[model samples]
Target: MLNGLGVWDIFLTLTTLTRGYLIWKVVNLLTRSTTGSTNVYQEICGQWVQTNTLTMDNADWGTFVRYAHRVKSIVIHNDSLFGNCKTIDVSILRALSMPPIPPASILFPQLRQLVCYDRRDEIYPFVRLLFGPKLTKVDVRLEASRSAQLAVLPSLAAWCPSVKKAELRVWRERPLGAGGINEVRALSDVVCKWRHLEQLSCGVGCLDDKAILHLGKLNSLRSLQLRISSHLTYHSVRQAEHGPLFQFLDHIHMVAIDSLSSCTSFFPLFSSLPPNITISPYAPYRSEGLCDLFTDLSVHESSGVLEDVSVEDHFQSTAPEEVFTIETLRPLLGLHRLRILSLETFYSFSLDDNALKEIGSAFPLLAELSLTADRGSNRHSKISVNGLITLLGLCPHLTSLSLTIDATRVDDIEPERRPGGGISNLNIDTLRLNDSKINHPRIVAAILFDVLPYVDVFAWEWGAHFDESDAEIYRPRWVEVQALLGAFRTVQEWRQPGFLPM
Candidate 1:
């Protein structure tokens, strides 16, 4: 009787172990089928799934579909998948033709943000598949083609009523034809339906007088970006009897304009904008328009509070001549609180010693400054090494500096002496220099090391000086400079152990 009882206990223990192994095998199979090869998705069966954001390009659709249920945010560029595909595969066509899953049973049920870039025809179907009640942010860029029609933004807005931020870009290779005005009017009518939208950016030719009025009705809107096209003429925007543009400008802190047609119409409205607001234009103003803008800004009381400004010219194949002079920029002296200034031109926006001196005197609190030219031209030859050193001395608080260095005449002129004594240590964190005519790298490196010892990043654009093979030749110079900088830092730290380097 004792032997029989012992045998029965061993049999029960074997059965329990067999059942546990079978359960483990089943779980592994399920995980492999559900999450594919990515280990991050293995534990995505519960609350952990909702924390993930997925970005999918044309080749990532299979992965996207496999884990769509777990993703919370999705950024997809579907242009390559459908835009030029003249013939769709029969299998894919059949899959797309099938009715969308019920809202209750849909994939990406927790998706809150959707960013899509595709042609108009492809964008609609892709958006339809991923639409969810919880989606609150949508950014769509529709590549403009002559065959493509304007996307009805209001209809898109209707699909996602909860969207608080919406950015729609419809860029065309060519200017819109005769019906562009009517298309813009339709867009104006549709945007008013987005009562919950707090931020909206619709690219050029979308903002007309009537549209601005409709946008004004969106009391929830706190930020807006509109491209200044021909539709926004000086007379139309300024002569408005009772439009909300002025009232809307009063509430927003940031305004960005793209492809500005002229500075005359835009600058006059500067007084209406709130004192704290910053204006950033995507394209450069023409030479004449920039002069007018500076002239107007010189006397404006609110210009003092304008802290950030970016000016770039329209990119062209042939380089343009100097667009601005020191005399033209003298008007900007009124901007006392300016901290950030960027002036980028195609090839020839000349800055001389006197101009650098004027800029240094004008904005004493400048922390970030950039004066970049795409290709070095004859106009850039006027900027010498002395001017740059003087400019650096004036703006002691500068943290980032990008300048075009024309070191052709450095040997002829002596380095400017700092008024107090030797070179004062610059707090510059990043230094970008372009077209250094100086052939010797050590001399260039030594000059920079003396003034900006604490610089963390050094970007030298050796345009014609060095080719791919010559990269090895320059490596020693860079290494030497870095070693010197490291030694300087070590000594400084030893001298003042408690002091923090910015």
Candidate 2:
């Protein structure tokens, strides 16, 4: 047929077909590009992206918008304006105001995960519409004049039925008028609604006695962590027994307990509950009483199901009892399920060879261990590194270990030297430390290269509080760390993971 047609006509027809194919390919490319300012669609299926017009360039927003309809997750990062605004920018303010969620039929209908870091007042309402029945996870970091936490209760109370994990941060709240009552009211109401909630972290400004009592209503809660500047009491935890608080609870954490002695009768409150509990010794005056509490609770023997324990207070105690060590921990060895252990601030306890062997017999199932020292000048007592290494020999099941080493042999006293070398036959896989005090280059080198060959993850960070010049002068320690880790099975600089510089 082509032979019958003229040569010029045939060539022109072939060129037109080729051009059409090329245009189709370009359209396909454009459709595939999901990140930009403008949303894109192909027939019925499409995606959308929301971009801050003020912050993101036109091209960037275009890229995001192109895929906006398909984007099930969104993240916004911006600081607060006044540090006191109560309102937040609703997540879908722009999208819902404009196109809104498309009317389509699918098994999972709404967006899955929404993360907002904006301080604008519109965030709360935005989250309400975007996270419908289908939302599973919501993380919002907001700064408001009235406190972002005020916005959290309503959003979580309504949507948490579908959410498995939720995190909220608020700046500050002034407890006054009906507004003060509002937070407590909201928390009480929402705890009942969020039946499926598993993990939660929120900063509640003034969680008074009444509000704390209301917290026990979350019966289905498994892992609950609260960071508050408010007062807490035994009745708060006591209310959990008959109410919604401890029905399915296996893990409970309360951090920054500015005053434990203020709640003196609190720890004994959980005696009737199950054995699994974690109490951070962050409150003042936990010295001997704190350790005694752990022993008493763990003495249930058969019911001693307490597997996780963390005591972060390491300051020199006013009490006269010996500092905690593997020897002291020997009594609780009868608590068979004790596995995860963490002790911070007090790192200078002596663990003799016999104690190490006893520890091996005690915590056979132990998996994660973290021992950290306080960086303050209060570390008047010296830590025995050799003894600690010898103690590690007993923990055959140990997998994760994090130690904050003051690396210096002695501070105020004449330079009393510590053991020079590291272990050779330990089964640890991950090791992390902040060893700014140690000036010896080979200290870490000895650990990484000669010892702990089985270790996989090694990390160390210079002290953030050190003077700039000190940090620079100490920068060589980091290099030494790299060199030491390099000689081992693997090597990488330690970047604080999920840790905000305090």
Tell me the tens digit of each residue's lDDT in model 1 across 438-466.
44555555566667777743434443322
**Estimated TM-score per prediction?**
0.68, 0.60
Alpha carbon lDDT of each predicted model: 0.54, 0.48
What TM-score, to 2 decimals, does candidate 1 have?
Answer: 0.68
Candidate 2 residue-wise lDDT, 1-502, digit = tens:
2223333343343233222211110111123322334434332211222233222234433433333344355454443433422222243344332333332432124356766666555555544545556667767754435445455667656654687776654444431212245554554465545556767655433344544454455554567655333244445456544533354567666554454443234444343344455555443543455555556655533346578776665223443323445545655667666787776543334434455456556777877766544332113223334434555655657777765444554223222432223335456756665443456666645544444666643333523232455555655775676566665433322343654433
lDDT score for residue 449 of model 1: 60
After superposing candidate 1, which stretches have Cα over 4 Å from the reference? 1-71, 78-97, 100-109, 144-152, 175-179, 216-222, 234-261, 268-271, 274-286, 377-381, 408-426, 456-502
